[model samples]
Target: MVEYALMLAIIVGIGWLIYNQTQLSDKINSVFNNAGNLMNDAASKSAKPPTT
Candidate 1:
C-alpha cells in the first residue's frame, strides 16, 4: 500500500515537471522568434540603398 502511494506521488511529480518544462519551452521559443524577426528587419533596412 505504501509502495502504491509512493509510485502515485512520483508519477504526479513527474507530470507536473513535464508540464512546467513545456510551458517554459513555449515561452523561450516565442522570445527567440521575436528576436530573430527583429534582427532580420534590421538587416534588411541596413541593406537598403540610400537615396540622395
Candidate 2:
C-alpha cells in the first residue's frame, strides 16, 4: 500500500512539473515574438529614405 502511494505521488509531481513547464514555455515564446515584432518595426522605420 505504501509503495502504491509513493508511486502515485511521484506521478502527480511529474504531471505538475510538466504543466508548469508548458505554461512557462508559452510565456517565453510570447515575449520573444513581441521582441521580434518590435525589432522588425524599428528596422522598417529606419529603412525609409530621409526627406528634407
Candidate 1: residue 28 Cα off by (Å): 0.2
lDDT of 1 by residue, 1-52 (tens): 9999999999999988987978977888999999999999999999999989
Candidate no. 2 TM-score: 0.57
Worst ten in a row by lDDT for model 2: 19-28
The list of candidate 1 runs beyond 4 A from truth reads 1-22
RMSD each, Å? 6.7, 6.8
Positional deviation of residue 42's Cα in model 1 after best superposition, in angstroms: 0.2
Query: Candidate 2 local accuracy as lDDT?
Result: 0.94
Report lDDT per candidate: 0.95, 0.94
